[model samples]
Target: MRIGELARRCNVSTRALRYYEEQQLLTPGRHPNGYRDYPESAVETVRRIRTLLDAGFNADTIRIVLPCLNGDDVDMCPQVAAAIRDTLHGIDEQLRDLETKRGRITALLAGRQL
Candidate 1:
């Protein structure tokens, strides 16, 4: 298969596939003509990548855990668990910061003291 076929099967754009390759997430071989030659298993690899990205896992974390993924199941070793916990903690911190900003804005709108 080629890049186009892999992108179609994965329902993602060729640019996205290229970006994935650039991110070192997907590795496809090349033909003598300089065209990318993707393996048949690339389809499943793309699927897993998309699933992890949609779940808010960063490319760095996904790279670490990609090999641990088998279909929808994850090995969830200590590293994976720690990665997940770190992501969750980051999200929580962002939410708390947003809440504080919202409270400050609301107080300003209500003309109340902080």
Candidate 2:
């Protein structure tokens, strides 16, 4: 299908699709007119990509896990395992940082009079 159809099916903007392409997350073919022609699988692929994005996984991590995404149970290869472990570690650090920041913000708010 065309870019517009793929975008509509995924409920994502054309620009997002372009960004996905740039991120190497989605690959579309080009028509003779130079317009993008995405395969039907692109719809599901975009959805999977979006799901990973929503989960706070970066594009790079998504790319790493792409192969395992199709399966219900992730039996990761060493490479995929490392990628996921690294992502989890990163998220842990981020959560700790956010918790600290939240505490500081809350203290500041509490010490101030409206």
Candidate 3:
């Protein structure tokens, strides 16, 4: 398959595929005429890449974690574990702040003295 075909199969744009290659996320072989020649597996690879990106993983984290992904076993990579822990910690802090704001709003709605 070529870049366009790979993009279509993966539901991504050709530009995105090129960007993935530039990020060293996917590596397609060059054709004799200098066009890209993507293996059939490129479709799945692109999907995995997009999934990681959607999960708040950056390119560097994805590069470190993708190779360790197998059958949903991402924790096998220590980097993946660390990244997930950090993301979770950030979420926890955000939740605490939001809860504090909610309490303030509730108190104001009840006409409570602050």
As a TM-score, model 1 comes out at: 0.86
Residue 27 of candidate 2: its Cα lDDT?
A: 91
User: Candidate 1 lDDT, tens digit per residue, 50-91?
Assistant: 988998889999888898987768899999889989888988
Worst 10-residue lDDT window for candidate 2 reads 67-76
For residues 1-114, what per-residue lDDT tens digits would candidate 2 score against the true structure? 998899888899999999999999999999899999898899889988898889878999988898687555665889889998888899999999999888888888899532
Report RMSD for candidate 3: 3.1
Off by over 4 Å in 3: 90-114
Q: How do all models score by TM-score?
A: 0.86, 0.88, 0.75
CA shift of 63, model 1, Å? 0.4
**What clash count does candidate 2 reach?**
0
